[model samples]
Target: MLQAKAYFDTHHHVGVIDQRIFSGFLEHLGRAVYEGVYDPESPLSDEQGFRRDVLEALRAMRMPLVRYPGGNFVSCYDWTDGIGPREQRPVRVDYAWKSRETNQFGTDEFMAWCQETGIAPMMAVNLGTGTPKEASALLEYCNLPGGTYWADRRIQNGHEQPYDVRLWCLGNEMDGDWQAGHVPAEVYAQRAKAAAIIMKGLDASIETVACGSSGRGMSTYLHWDRTVLEYCWENIDYISAHRYSENRRGDSAWFLAEGVEIDRVVEDYAALLNYVRGVKRSQKRVYLSFDEWNVWYKNMEMDGKGESAPHLLEEVYNLEDALVCAQYLSSFIRHADVVKVACLAQIVNVIAPLLTKRDGLLVQSIYYPIVSFAQHARGLSLVPALECPTYKAGERGDVAALDAAMSYDEASGTVAAFLVNREQRQEMRVVLSLGDQRFCEVLSVEVLGGGDAKAANTWEEPKRVTPRSAEAHVNEAGELIVTVPAPGLAVVRARVSKR
Candidate 1:
């Protein structure tokens, strides 16, 4: 087996890992909101029309937060349209996805679903066709106590208590022309500034996320972000980032090196945030909300055809995609200080980890890594110094064959390390060097890997590419040893104490 070395000290930590970083997203687009999560007609659904099996799977993943109501769908969405009686609700044309929205599952339904599933809701307002006043009104409806117009409306609607959603997005991808109301950076920043000011004024405790550049591929990427931050610096708490990696070239090494690309994106955004803060000389810091991110190039075609809950962007993730997903989690942990919140875009049937049918749920290959990381990778993120061989990843330059991140929970004396081997055909044996704190015993070692890179899971064969138990131990020399399969990822957790 190939050999690698990694060194870590409990003292040299990155930051406290925010549990929200292991979050998921749900959009009104495709089947994500309809048959995916909310289905009144399914036998698997609860009384509120939420899919019981889907909620169970999500709970198993340990997702703490879920971004709701939109992706591009919210750009033109009217929250009020979905609020009142279902019989009176109007069915509008969803301009973003070219589908029809029945408004059957609206704000109250979503909040109820979130409450039952134990996930915090992160909402996005419509800035495309909506006004700042409208944005503030929605905030008031969700967060304010009674006696006001919107709050009283909420009361009349049967909810006396406020939803009190803390995290709000000004808009979704306002810089993209494909969006419902794509505008110039100056215009978006102006609108965002107004919205944030009023929204915060309404609640004063809510944290707002200003829209940054849609993606690095945009011509106005950094420029748009700079303008927005320079405008909404004090009002907003975090800048929203959206990223989706594609295996366009069919190069496994380059595809697996997506983590390096993710690192670059985070670093670039962090630098931009710092620059804006310096320019404003502001004491208040803005972190990143990587709200929409995942491997999404597989199913780009949207075949909505005016249908409700069409199978749009329903990507069947392969083993390589799962490895890429692991890399994403590892990178998020490595940059836990800067990237405080991340949502795996669209949690069900829309380029998601869990695919839902009327009868059953299909857990994708990417689901295992997410579950592993979310379950064990918690508490303080530890910085690991690694010595590993490198492979050329095209424009990404020389990329390490081994990618890794570590987290230690002081309260539980638990240390969990997530490792990925990018080599296509060789297993790598890694020796972990712990300084001062020696691992006492191995808790569990699980590997998500298979011989075929393109292996995926389907309803017919749900466990086709699932994770299996692996071997790892604390050696007599006070080191930890584990062998990770090629083109695979592993999560090794152990009990630890000071030497």
Candidate 2:
């Protein structure tokens, strides 16, 4: 076994764990909305047309917030087209994904879905082909009480009360040329500033997110973020960053180590945010919204094929993907202070954790780590100092063999640790030392690994890659000695007693 030591001190705190950090994303693209979450034709659907099974899955995950409507789809989406009578809704051509938008699910429907599932809505407006006035109208419709045109229109459409959506995104990836109505950084910054001002002026309580860069690989990554912040830092509360990891080279080690890239992405953006804050000499701090992220490389050819193309971008995740996702969540916990919110790109079907057939659904391997962290990892984030072995990879050289983060809930006297063993063949012997804190008993230990790294949960074998209970114990010295399997992820919980 590979040896490692982890030190956790209550004094060495990062920040309070934001529940929104574990949030998910839902877009209009692919089967995410049509067959995945809203399958009115299926027996699994409820009276409202929302799939009961999907709702159950989402509820089980304890997702706190969900970003609504569009990834690229939002760039050309007209919110009004989705509201009012479904029969009268127009079938517009969605240039973003080259699909025909049936306009069945709109702003009202998404808000209603969020209400039904008890998740907060993070609404994104169409800055690509939309104006500040249109964005403000959306705010009025969602947040304002009846009596005004848009507010009363919302009432006439059936919802009597306001949705009171607090989080808003000014645009979706405005910095990318691939995005519809894509603008240069300076141009996008000005437009975002105007939209932010207008929307906030309409509803001061609503928090707005300015589009940063699409990803770190963009030609203008941090520069785009800096320019947007320079122009709209005070107006916007958060800046949006999106990333999608891929195993295109078929390198398992490189694939599992993608979390290192995610960590660097957060660090770079956070550093930029801090630098901009200092330069402006502004007391108002702008945090990061890693609102869109996931592993998306499997079905690239099927995307952008227009209305004829169905089942677009549905990725079948394997054991390695799950490990990478777990490491991503661990990275979020490590930077809880700067990364205030993160949406797992999507929640269902389209490169998502949950996949659906016509009448049934299969929970992907990535879903295990999500629910594990969401349910167990809460409260204060502890900055754990780790002494672990390292390996030399291609790009991310000298990467640690083990990636881990810990959280302590003082009220419940519970401490939860999330660990990922990145090594392909070596199980890690991890000795966890909590300074002056005694864990009386090991509460639970769930490990998500052991099978083939490429093995995935199929409809026939849904339970094939599920997490299993692991052996964990508290020694006489009150430290945790746990064996983390190679190429796996583990969540360990313990009852911490007052020393």
lDDT against the true structure, per candidate, is 0.90, 0.89
Q: Write the per-residue lDDT of candidate 1 for residues 1-499, one digit (tens) a residue.
A: 7799989999999889998899988899899999989998999998888999999999988888898888899998999998988999999999999899999998889999999999989999999888899999999999998999999999999999999999998999999999988999999999999999888888888998989888999897889999999988988999989899999888877898898888889999989989989999989999999998999887887858899888789998999999998888888899888998999997999999988879888999989999999999878999989999988777778989899999999999989999999888888999988797998899999998847888898877888898999999888878899999888888899998899
Residues forming the 10-long window of minimal summed lDDT in candidate 1: 450-459
Clashing pairs for model 2 are 98-306
Q: Write the per-residue lDDT of candidate 2 for residues 1-499, one digit (tens) a residue.
A: 8999899987788989999989999998888898888888989999989999999999988889999896788888889999999999998888877777788888888888898999999999999999889989989999899889999999999999899999999989998888899989998888999998988888888899999998988898898899999999889999988989998988887777888899899999889998999999999999999999888898784454666226888899999999988988899999989989999989998899999887998999999999999998889999989999987655677788889899999889899999999888888989999996987899899898864789999998899899999988889988998988878887999998767
State the displacement of the C-alpha of residue 287, model 1, in Å, after optimal TM-score superposition: 0.2
Q: Count clashing residue pairs in model 1.
A: 0
Q: What lDDT is reached at residue 196 by model 2?
A: 88
Regions of candidate 2 where Cα sits further than 4 Å from its true position: 302-304
